[model samples]
Structures are given as C-alpha cells and as structure tokens.
Target: MVFLPSLPAHMQRRAPSRRLGVWLWALALCLCLFGEGAPAWAADGEGDITLSSRYWIDASGVQSVDEVAAQPAGTLVEMDGFRSFSLGSSALWMRLDLPRLDPSQRWFLLLSAAAFTNEVDLYQRGADGGWIRQRAGDHLPVAQWDHPDQTPVFAIDAKVQGPVWLRVMNSPTPTSPRLQLLTENSLQTKRYWTFLMVGGYLGFGLLVLFLGWVHARLYGDRAFVAYCFYVAFMLGFQAAFTGIGGLFFWDQSARWNDMAPAVFMLWLTASGIWFVREVCAVSRHHRGVDRFVIAWSVFGLLYPLLYVNLQTPAAFAVLNLYGLLSVLLSVALCLWTWRLGEAYSGWLVLGFLPVHLGYPFPALRSAGVLPDSWAMQYAVLIGSAIEIPLLLYILHRRAKDFNENRARLRALESTDPLTGLTIPLVLTLRLRDALRRSRRYGHRCGMVLVELANHAEIVDREGREAGDRALVVAASRLSAVVRDVDTVCRVSDTRFAMLIEGPQRPEQLKLLAQHVVARGLERVPTLPVELTLRFRLVSATLPESGDSSEAANDDERLMERLHRALDRLASEPRRVVLHLPVRMPAGA
Candidate 1:
C-alpha cells in the first residue's frame, strides 16, 4: 500500500473542501477567543504571557525543591494557554533589554511565568553588579515542596521601571534546568472587561445567597437550610480563590486558598448528595442503588488531594474524565429512578446535563485544548445557575411528598381501625411533642382524661358491630368540636385523652373541657343514646426559662404529676373531677 497524506482519488479531490471547513473552524475559534472582554495582546519579540508558579525540578536532578537555594538566581517565564508543557524546564528565557518605559504612560507589565523553580523572588540588578531586593511586592510566598499544577500564569499589574531581574530558585535536585519566556501583550484596554466579569460573578453570587435566604423563609422548609449552607461554602471558597479574601480580609494567609478549595468541594458534594437523596426518597426504593450513587460521590470527594498534589495537565485530564464518568453515572441513576416514576428524579436528570458539560470546560481550557474566555467562564456559571432551579424544584416536590406521607402515616397510626377514633399510641406521641414545645417556649398546654361510662356493659348488650359504631360516632363528634391543635385519643378501651393549648389557668382548662364534653353529648342525640362520660381537666404552666431540653424534662414531670392529680380527682363518688393547676418546680 502506498502512503498518502490525503485520501486517494475522491478523498484527495475533497481536500480543498476539508481545508475550507478547517479554516471556518479556526475562524470561529478566533471569534470566540478575541470577541469581547479580552485584551488584544500581540506577541512582540519580547516574551511575556500567562504565568503561575509551582516547585520546579532543581539542582541535583531530583524533584526536591530545596536545591533551588544553591543555584544562581534566575527568572521564571511562561506563555499563554496556547503554549504547552508547563511542567518541564523552559526551552529558553528571552530577556527584554528595553530602556524603562515612561512609568506614567498607563502601561501594564505582562510577565509570563512558564514555571517557577521552588520559589521565585524579584530583585534589581544594581549598578554595582549586586542583586538588591526590588521591594515591588511581587514575590509570591513559597509553597510546600508538594505543589499543585497550575498553568504558567501571566500576572498583570502596572508597569514598574527599574533594572529588575526575577530570581528563580529551584529545588536542590531539579531534573531539568531551564526557564521560558513568551511575548507580552499590552492589557490597557482589557482592564475594564476584567473588572466587569469579576464584579458580575461576585454580585451574582451575593444575590443568589440573598434570594435563597428569602425563599427559605417563605417556604419554611428545612432543605432550604441545607441549601443555604452549601451555597455559603461555595461562595466563600470562590471569593477566597479570587484573592478577594486576601485583599479584603487577610493578606498573609495564602494557606486558606491552598486548603479551602478542597474542603469546600467535599462539603458541597456531600451536601448536594444528601439533598438529592432526600428529594428522591432514594432510601424508599432500591436502597442498594441509592447507596451506590452515594458511594460514587466519594471519587470527587477524594480527588481533591490528588488534584492538589498533582497539578499537571495529565492530572487535570484524568480528573475531567473522572468527573464526567460520575456525572454520567448519576444521570443514569436519575433516569432509572424517573422511569420508575419517582417525582424528584426528573429534576436530577435535568440538572445533570449542565453540570456534566460545564465542569470539564475549565479543565479543557486549562489544558490549552479549549479557548479560554469570559464567555467560557460564564458558561460554567450559567450552568450552575441552571442547577439551582432544578434543586429548588426537587425540594418543592420533596416537601409535597413529605406532607402527603405525613398525613397518611398519621391516619394509619392514630385512627382506630373500626371506630375511626384517635388511637392511644398516636395521640400520646403528638401530646408529648406539644408538651415539649410548650415547656420550651413558655406556651400553655392542658390535658383532659375522658372515660366512657359503662363501655363494657354497652358492648355486651349491643353486638360488637353496634359497639364499634357507637365509638366511631363519638370520635366524629369529638373531632368536630375540638380545634385542630387539640388532639383526641382513645388511651384505652374505655379511657380517652384530649390535649389542648390555651391560656395556662385551671379555670380556663376546666371550662374548655366542660364545653367540649357538653357539645359532644348534645351531638349524641337525646332519644335512644344514653352515652354518659366523665372527664378530668389538668392544667400546668410551662417554665419561662425556655430551655427545650430542660422543658422536655419538665413536661415528663408534669405528666407524672397530672396522673397523680387524676388519681385524687377520681376519689369523688358521683361525677368526674376537674383537677386545678398545681404549681411545681418553677425553674423546670
């Protein structure tokens, strides 16, 4: 077979069209790269480009950064994102020997740092041939020998006129020995765009926080609380990353930047996973699959340290692939859940696409494979914005499901199977909760114990079915007369409990109980229904100290005291006794 650059015959003839297509793509890429908010920088012979620094291979041909201390001080150089191979030694450093530009010319200096040895320091070459500190506040603090991979950064700043030389120190044992410099472009026109982009992100983030807080209050949902916490972590981390934390908060602690990103990503991921799981009710269906989805999140959670230690382009690519895989898996799980008719799963599926597409764009751009621009950064932000609404939708659906399930479960547990009256178990638990709340908040709560007179005799004389009907009727009448906050429960075969909230006084509790009993009897009908019953009202005052835990304890004690008071009130021969409020431990 003969080797050919282009395909033979028809393919060769199509080469022109292929070239045209490639030119169109190139044109599109150019528009994307230079369309707006970008500083037009031509690559003049003097090399200045994007620059960031990490420990460089140093003196002893090892990766140890300590060796940089022993080498002749050199300058670190970098190029734009278009340049590749940021980790190895720069091929050459092109020195700019221009006479100092007029400092008042609104000039900006763009020094491209391909890579720094362990640390880079700026010094001025004195006329006496000694290197003196430039004192320009340009030196970044040294990082741990273990540094993350960041592309060579071009730190932009106002031009400084001096005989300046950047001192690049390598680890004592660098495997490569070299520095690179790339063409610097004037950025005077691009400053406004940069300010706007940064300002927009900050303002948008703040607005999201404010709106989320307001939405939380309006909805009164606990999930929003979690959402707020998650957003707080993310916004705080982003602010810290952009150097605003240093500028506005503290300048010396660069360590926060180093550590916070990893921590924030983990916390945010966990919170997001938990919120999704709750919304989807993953625990209710296919617990194993839910657990697997949860387990998969650990990959992102664990990858941060790897990212920190290996800030190489290859590491970035690996991470991008890993993130994409996780997103795909999540999408699959969400779709499966949706197919099974789960309500919140649709939101998860909708949210996944943007997050899946958006997260990897940064890695691609950082790797020089995708054009870096304001639009690209905003695309990620826009995708994140889309995700927020999906989460809110999920929360709303979850709240609806929660309310429905709560009503169903309450009915199942509390209502008597045959009579539809409140069962003892359900009413007791509800009463306990209200009492606990009342004690904690200094709210008034009262209880009435009711006994159906001669229930066993009625059941014996009437068939079991008739007895059950009577109980059902009594329950319906009791429910109609009492307020929604009040609970009526059949504590035993013949005994019932009614809990109410109102002013904390013995007379008021007795009156309320008497009214309920009187109204209930009137509803029973006068002809054939004898329906005699007795009730005792017990009232108590919650402590003003308002300690919920202490209040819980006090509620338990009050309940015990009420039982005692009931025992004494029952001593009366003919009628039911309405016990008066008995003051106990005021502190309790």
Candidate 2:
C-alpha cells in the first residue's frame, strides 16, 4: 500500500451530508493512489504526455546504468510531483514507465531546464534484454547531441517496453527538472514558435545596435558609444542564455559553450552600468554616486575572471547578487540625477523601468529562490525588447538638442542679438576676403553704407521701442533686397553696411542703392503712419588690379573711407545717394 501526503484543510472539512462527503473522500484517495500511478502511453498521442508523478532517487554522485538498475525497488522514492535540486556535483536518477507506441510515429522526451544540467544520459531496454544508452546536454557540443536543440531532447524508441532510466548531472546553477513527452508533430510546432520569437528578438536587437553605433559615430558622443556596447552585450547574453549561441554561433567549442552564458551576463551588466553613467551625466552632478558606479562596473567586469576559475555554487550566487545590486543602483542613479534636473535622466528612468521590473524573476531563479516558470524563461527578453529601442530614441533626442544648443551659442557670438544681422567683426572678416578676391581675380565688389537719418527723431516722437522696431524693419528690408552671397551688418547704432560680391557695372550699384532707399521710405506699420524712415546712402566699388589706392587691400581703411563719404553725404540734405570713385581716399 502506498501512503500519500495529507490533503488540504478545505478538502478535509466536514460536509453537510456526512455519507456523501465520505464517498467523495474515498474516490479522491483512490484516484491519487491508483489512477495517477498508471504508466503513461505514447501511442497515438496528439499532444504532450503528462508524467508529473514518477519515481526518482538521489544517486549522490556518478553512477553507471548497470549500478542504477541493480538497486532494489525499496531504494526508489515515489515523487507525486516535479522536483527542484540545489546546484552541486550530485546526480539524480528518474524512472519513467512508457507503454508501447505506434511504430509509424516518432517521439521525444524534453528536459525543460536543459541549461542548468551539464549532462543527461538516458537508458532503455533493448530487444536482446540489454540496456541501450543515449546522451544529450550542455557537456557536449550541441551538434553532437542525440537531438540538437536549445534544451536537452532525447528520441524515444517505439519498440522498447518497460521502464526507462534517466540520469541528470547538475551544474553550478539551480535546477528544476520538468519532463514532457512529445510526438514529432507536436515537437515541430513547439520548435517553430520558439525559433520565430527568439529570431525576431535577435534581429531587432541587431538593428538597434547598428543605429546606436551610427549615432556614436555621427555625434561623437560617449553616451551613444556606451549604449552600443551595452546593446551588443545584451544580444550576446540573450543568445547564450537561450542556448542559441550553442546551437548556432559556437556549437563546436565545448569550453566556450559552457562559459558563454556567465561571461556574457557579466559583461552585459558592466556595460549597462557604464551606459547609465554616461547618458545621465552623473559625474557632473554627484561625485560620490559616480565613483561608486564606476567601481561597481569595474568589479562586474573583473568578477567573471574569478567565476570562470572557480565555477562553484558560491560563485554563481555572487553573480546573481551582483546583478540584483546593479539593477537597484541603476534605478537609484536615474532618480537622483533626474531630481537634480538632468534632461536625459528622466528619459533614462522611463527607458529602464521595463527591464527593472522583469529582472527579479531571473535573478531569484538563478539564486535558487524561485521555481522554473514562464517569467523566469522570457520575462527579461520581453522587457528588453521594449527597452532597447526606447533608450535609442532618448539618445537620439539628446544628440539633437545638443546640436541645436551649440548652433545657438555660435550665432550669439557672430551675429547681433536684436537685429539678427552679422556684427562689425564678422563683417570685417568677410570684407577682407572680398577685397582679396577683387585684387586677385580682377572683379569689382562694392560696399553700401546706409545711415538711418531719422532714427533719433523717431525715438523722440515714439519712444525707444519705436526706434528699435524701425531698425529691425530696416535690417529686414536690407536683407530681402540683396543676393544670398552678400553680407549685411549692423555696424553702429544708426548705421548699416552691405558687402556685395560682383563683376558689376556702375549701373547695378546705382540700382541697388535706389532699391535700398526705396524700401527704407515705405510706410511704417509698427510706427505712426505719418512717420517714415529716411536714409543717406553712399556706394563705392572696391579697387581691382591696376588701381593705385593704398586701401585696396586694407579692409579697415576701405571701411573708413566709406564712412567719410557717408558723412559728407549726410551734410548735403538735398542728396539721397553718392558714389565714391575707387581711386579716391576718404579726404582726397
């Protein structure tokens, strides 16, 4: 007789009808003892065959199939459900009774927690009454396994009968053994969806990584470069953890096949911390936190060296602990920098929120605190898929804002703040370039100096605001009338200058002067309708080759000569425009 564990308190509670409740209790007991203990059938099964309850034994260490089979039946412990084991060098042996199956169909036994087990050897009775052995697991290259997959899968013999034995050797990570029996069709469907989802995730991650690299190169931003490294390591971690690396990337190398997951995980964490530090600009705000983060990153990078050498349960525990601490530290840094008013820090918090919520499932599982579940398998994958693209967008925005601010600063240096026109210094440089071109290329370039003669009169009548508006209007008019190659400058309080590149006749200079005067005299909209702007204009062609003027190559002297001509024109109220000869100096 088999004794079972006690039922729940709710099930044992007294019912209103005592006889009926007694009968129900008897039925439940019979189902637990007899019905659930029956052998599972693989013949004509359309889906998974359930083997939740089976017999298992702790073999303690390495044992041969013959030794395990020779053990007395009393040594086997009956397990009514799945079991989890602490990671160590110990091994476990399970007995599964499979009935005869259809000869035409193929079947497979899947070990769901394949990554946590180093080796799994399956034994079956042959027709000659000898035990036949098969092998699958991470200890050997995936290509050499009985059935190559991300998990341990062994082919089931349709002609075999009676009990089959399975021995599992645990690695340095926690192990929860789940067994599922599948037909070929069912296995194909499972593989289809699994490959599709993992493939989609890997493709998306690569695209985002490429974009991050482009941003790093285009902007020359340390933050973007850090993000690229973070993403690359993230992809590697996912590949290794999901067993894709063993199956496709490095299938032939058994050493790297065993070490890839831990190494990539460590590098992923280190690069993530470094990325956070860069994107948040944490060093500029808090030196203490920044230094702590740097130290943690360095530790994360170097800890793998010790872990690879030791390969102990304690070392695996340390890896999980470090991952948990890194998550907490990253979140705290984001919040701290955000409160200090860092623009990108707020985005960093949002971008990291999904991964933060998903990290605990895998972290606890790795620490041996949680059972294998869907959350432990794919939670981080889903969260990171959302996070990577979001973070890239934040980086893009950061780059764009930085570029705009830089352009604004440069504009403030070279242009007048109110009128949005070049200042005297910028105008002086351009004028020098134009004079050199005129002498070298034998081309004539002209300068027009216009004074707002009624500026003070408007200020006295309508206040200084009106005078400022008039200057703005004049600047706009001057800008609209010139070609794009010309430079317009507000040289003084009541004077403006224009440098026009040319191979022009005198007629064009006169025409431009007339246009400047006409636009200035238009009716004022921002001022009193009766008040109109008055202008005094003087134009001169710069000296070309063969000209005798000493000021031909001197931009300052040429500008001084133009000013004197404008002053002379200002004295004659009857004259609206004057053209100075190229060979004449200011007072000549």
Candidate 3:
C-alpha cells in the first residue's frame, strides 16, 4: 500500500501509544473513503470500460442498501479478474468508475449473465450527489426490461460519468458475473455475433442428428435411435437451460424462461439413461441392471410432469440431485460394461464422462460455490459434441462388422466347407423353387447329376485328402464353365449336382453335358496319382424323374433319382452315360 508521509521526528517520538492509535484511526478512515473498491474512486478511466475488471465484493447476505453501506470498509474485498464472486443467498456490491465523457458520447452497460441472475440493481450518481436506481431481471415482465433483447442492457448517461454501484442479488447461486461497457453501435454488433453463435451451434447439432436418424432408417438399430433421442434431449436442455431459447425463441415467455431448464433436464436425464442402455447393449448383456435402467428412465420421463408446477428451492435441489445421481449411475454402467469386455464400451465411457464430470462445474459456478469460467461452462458441450461423431462412427463400424459376420455364418451353414459347393439344404431349396417356376411358366429346368465314377477308387488309392482336393478342383472347374443362372452343389462326398435352367432344347442339353464332361477332364483327379478323377455327366429334365414311393417332397424325389442314376453309373463300365446314352472314350 502507498502510505502517507511519515510524521515529524518530534511528533513521532512523543506519546507512542497515543500516536499509534491516531495513526490507526487515520488509516481506517483512508481505507473506508479511498480503498481500491471504494465507490468514491472511479474503477475505470478513459475510452471503454469492462466493468468486471474492477469490483468490490461483499458476500454479506444484507439486502438493504443502507445496511450494506454501514458495514466497515475492511469487510469488502477487491475482485482480481472477473466480477465473479460466489456468495450463497446473498448480494454482491460492485462499483465501476468511468472517466469523464463528453456530452456528445453515450454508453451502454451490457449484462450477459442473465440466465444465472434473477435480479440486478444499477445505481448511478446524479448531479445532486445521490444514487439513482434502476431495476432489471428475468423475473420482471418483458415490458419492464431495460433493453429489447434476451440479455439486459442498461443505458448510461455518459455526461454524468463518475462512479456507479450495482447491487447484484437474489441469484440461484453466487457467481462472478460478466459485464461489458460499449457504445450503442458496439452493443448491436455483440448481439449480432451472439445470434450467429447460437444459430451455428443449433445448426451443427441438427445436421448430426439428421445423420443419426438416417442410420436408424437404414439399419433399424436401437443404438442409433437412442442416439437421436439423446442428442435431441441434450440440445433441448442446452437451449432452454442456457437461456438461448429465451433470447432467440421465447424471450417474451416469462414462465417458460423460468421452468424450461428443469423441464427439459427431466427429459435429458431419461434420454441419456436410455441411450446408455441401447448403446451399451445393456438389455442383452446385463439383465439385472437393465431392469433398473429401464425403470429409472421411464420414471424420469414422467417425474417432471408430476412436479410440473413445483418450483421451490427444495424442488430445484431435488432435480439437481437426481441429475447428478443419474450421471453417476450412467458412469458406473459404462465402467461395468467396459470391464465386462464390451470393446465399444470404451467409446461409451469416454463419450459420457464429460457430462458426468462436468455437471458439478455448472452447479458450483451457478451456486457461487465456484467462479464461472469458460472451461466449466462449456465442458459438457465440447465433450458431447466430440462424442457424437466418434460414437456414430463406432456404431457404423459395429453394424458393418455385424452384417459381415452374419453373412459368414449363413455361408457356413449352406456351403460344403471342403469343396466350397452349395450343400444339400441350399440345393434342395433351389430345386424346389425351380420346379415351382417350371410348372407355372411351363419352362424346361434340367437337373444334371454328374457322378465321379472312380472317386472311391481314387480316395482309397491316393488317400482321402487328395480325393477331397480333386473334388474341390472339380467343383471349381464345373462352376466356372456354367452360366451364372445355374446352381451347383455336392449332394454326396463323391457326387455333385447342377441345376441348369434356360432356353436349352434336348440337343442343346446334349451339348451342355458334353461341355461338362470336357471341363471335368480339364484338371486330372488326385487319384490319377497324376489324379484319376473321371465322371459321366448325365442330364435329366425336372419332373421327369418324379416317380417316387416314400419321398414326401419334390426335392427328395430329385435326390432319390440322382442317387439311383449314380448307382447305375457305378455299375457301368464308365464308358457311356445312361440318361444321355452317349460314350466318352475309345480306350474304355
């Protein structure tokens, strides 16, 4: 502290205790009248003033101006950075001194912390050396507001510039508030930028939400659906609770401005819980916990309606408590899911941690338990916005993996693993469909039973592995030669069948059989030791071999006739095919 000049040598040396008391009284008077935050001193001088930079705070719960003024100056503390100070259920007295301004100039004091404060009082010194008062607050009617916008702006008579004292009181909590001094034109610019910011945030949220909705449409997945609800709830709660809705959409709705946060928060909690349930696959994996989550989520949606008109301190406290508890439960759920081996739960955990960890910051800052900072105010927004895209990407990856895996599973059931041929089940179904089509359309559908005549001999001679390899090669060769419309499958280890449908007459069928025989000879069978795979390819028209006794279905009849044909082929000299009535080689 800068001190006054020392007393003269004789005056200082005499009556030490009396001198000490006199000096102390003088110091006390000086601090009271000219201390850093003394209203008599102008806190700001010159061009433009950011009133938050200079403030004197009294966390005194006193509401009367006279009472607060009577308090000793030592009780008031100077603010260091922002006009932010937390005093629960009390008022903060702030003083801003502006240097003299010419009569031609005008100034506006902008109060941007409208959402957090319920009432604010502005007092400016008049020519008569007395403070003149003006009132502004959210609780007041729109007509009573000092300015015509979402946030409050009070006009300053620059010609009467000196010092101004504002009594900020009756907020939900103690907070360091934001205040800006500007010319009328600058205030307009600030409003414009604020408008753009709010609009941009909402726009970006909607675009992502549309993407989530698209995902739900394409895949019909519960996670995507839940995510859409989650984002909606989050965005709604942010809009209402942050007072953006009042500024942009509901400025005239005083009741809505008051109740919007609690009401929207109710839905937000429920949606967040439900989203956790779906994204974490809680119902499928954690049956016991799932019931609790569902019950709580359902209750949360209805709880706000139950207490719709209940606006008390206790009510607000209870709602905040429930919100915090919900976050804890969700956090725990994520941790449990992560621990239980859900790999994607890592994304869920990190995605949700910000809201959980950040909830307290806003609560603390609002209640004057902590000072407001950008980090505390926007932590959840930054975190959740980041999580939205990352989580969606994770969901996309999961869905893709799910579809690919399902296809592989179906393949396993329908194909011959050893030779990569369609198995009996699939082939049977295809044949039945072919028969139905043939009967309806009166079109010819041919069944070709191509039997590996020397397959057993080769298996016994060259070992089963070689025989299997030869069957694989034969299946590949046959499949390659057939048109895409044809179906090929192995009914037995050594015998295969092909369903051929198209514009093919009897002569054309003969040519197709010959082509198959030629192709089958392309790769020598494994037993030829040099591979000995040899086959007589026979073709039969559908329903031609339907003379059946015990077979209950057309599919069975086809298989039965093919087996009988194979038996005939096995008994023959392997020179001619019985159905085709043709010979292949001169040597045999």
Q: List the candidates ranked by TM-score, beginning with the highest.
A: 2, 3, 1
The predictions' CA RMSDs to the true structure, in order, are 15.8, 12.1, 16.3
Off by over 4 Å in 3: 1-77, 80-89, 101-106, 125-136, 141-144, 298-325, 353-360, 404-443, 452-477, 514-536, 542-558, 572-588
| Model 1 lDDT-worst window of ten | 144-153
lDDT score of residue 194 within candidate 3: 52
Provide TM-scores for the models.
0.47, 0.85, 0.74
Query: Model 3: per-residue lDDT, tens digit, 433-486?
Result: 887776566565777888776677667877978777778888887798678988
lDDT of each prediction vs. the true structure? 0.50, 0.79, 0.66
Clashes of 1: 35
Cα-based lDDT at residue 20, candidate 2: 32
| Candidate 1 residue lDDT tens string, 1-588 | 111132335334533444434543653464476445324453332222223332323333333222333344453333323333333333222222334444334333332221222334334344575444421111232122121112112221225433333434321112122222322224433434444554676677677767668767866765677677666665654444333443444344444444444355455555565555555667778979778767766665777777767655466566556645555555666656665666456555554445455566544544445544444344444455545655565566566667778777878775776656677666667766766666656666667666555456557776666566656666666676668877887765655567776445666666766775675455344224665433344444443334445544454565577667666666764656555554545355
User: Residue 444 error for model 1, in Å?
Assistant: 26
Model 2 agreement with the true structure over 279-376: per-residue lDDT tens digits: 88989987887898899999989998999899988898899888988887887777677667675676676677667766777777766777665457
- After superposing candidate 2 on the true structure, give the runs of residues whose Cα lies further than 4 Å from its correct spot: 1-51, 55-59, 66-83, 457-470, 522-534, 544-546, 568-576, 585-588
Top candidate (lDDT): 2
